[model samples]
Target: MLAAATALFALVASASAQALPSSAASPEQLALVDAQYNASGFPDSGAILTVSYASFVVQNGNAYTAEQVATAPTIYVTPSTTTRDEFNSSSVYTVMLADASSLGDPDTEGNYRRVLQRSTHYLVNGQTGTSTGSNYTFEPSGGT
Candidate 1:
């Protein structure tokens, strides 16, 4: 009985850990990103948008050729406008550039993970206003 209880506890703990939420972009966030990208005049004619717990991406967009998706620089967005505290917190969304070459053995899923890792752009809500840079720019719609 003692051993069974211990095993059950361990299983529960592992399951709980696996079930913990990751800060990935939401549908609303994705739409905001798309709008901002369009507003910036950065064409994404062939890009594909995908979402996962790890990241959100505009894969194979006009930003990069199909073959170059592995090494292209990408924009990343936080699920919501980040506060100074949230930006400093560990639970902040993962937005960075991830290369397809660095993905995994199978490469497909790994490529997605890598893309999530390499997101360099962030999406700010209307409340936060707009921001711009040499490599990245975000202008929220509706004059916000």
Candidate 2:
């Protein structure tokens, strides 16, 4: 009886550990993230911005591409004004977004886990009252 009880407790503990992150954020937070993603519309300035994604690589007995990697909630960050021409000509600045998690994980092969959460981030260059347009577009690789 003692052994059976101990085993049951261990199983329950394991299950709880896995379930913790699922409920980390409240429904309100999730809604806010969704709104931000949808509200990131561009202006009519005809400016374009290219984006690149980079992050740590976790090796769990195998390699994975960026797409294969699990990224956390993503956030889009844009410039305050149209920077497409500036970004292209100067190559100094670019737009960015992130998907982050409070409880980051690691793979079983002693590697940090990739973003697994669905939270996403996005940015707009100006506020509703601001007239400074910063509409942008991305110049994907290989003209694709």
Candidate 3:
């Protein structure tokens, strides 16, 4: 057990703190992700992700401020304004909402995990996506 723990520690110590995306993103996108990840404290995620999917943070009719989203009950992703026709209608997608500051906003387990200005982050899973013509509608795997 001691040897196994040592091996694990070595593996983690050698890994890059910067997230290396597994998905195919353009150079620009990859750069942006790296910058954001670095800026956000290079989270110690349970499982390192290879690709960060594009997700919209819309509250009103369009993009919203964190303050706006902090109070909103529902937030969903709409089709990308520039590329609406490139989506595959039959593809099922796994959408992850990570980096949501869960520190100092509201009470999450009495810890108050509502990030006001990029505090600690959290990874929200179980939300799956289904293509709806030119857009995708995401819902919890079991139901809405």
Q: Count the backbone clashes (under 3 Å) in each candidate.
A: 9, 19, 6
**Residue pairs whose backbone atoms clash in candidate 3:** 21-50, 22-50, 22-51, 102-113, 103-113, 105-114
Task: Write the residue-wise lDDT of candidate 2 on 1-144 in tens digits.
Answer: 000000011001111111112222234433433343343331222221112224432211233344533342111222223332333322422222333222123345332223223222332232121112233322212110
For each candidate in turn, give its C-alpha RMSD to the true structure in angstroms: 19.1, 18.5, 14.9
Q: Which one wins on lDDT?
A: 3
Clash list (residue pairs), candidate 1: 47-61, 76-121, 96-117, 96-118, 96-119, 97-118, 97-119, 98-114, 98-118
| Residues forming the 10-long window of minimal summed lDDT in candidate 1 | 1-10
lDDT against the true structure, each candidate:
0.27, 0.24, 0.28
| Model 3 weakest lDDT span, ten residues long | 1-10
Ranking of candidates on lDDT, top first: 3, 1, 2
Cα-based lDDT at residue 74, candidate 1: 29
Task: Give me the candidate number with maximum TM-score.
Answer: 3
Q: For candidate 1, give the lDDT of residue 22.
A: 36
- Which digits, one per residue and each the tens of the lDDT, describe model 1 over residues 1-144? 010100011001101112222343344544544554453334322211221223223332224333433342222222233221222222322222223331113545543444335442222222221333221222122211
Over 66-105, each residue of candidate 3 has an lDDT whose tens digit, in order, gives 5433431222223223322333333333332223332223
The model with the greater TM-score, 2 or 3, is: 3
For residue 62, model 2's alpha carbon misses the true position, in angstroms, by: 23
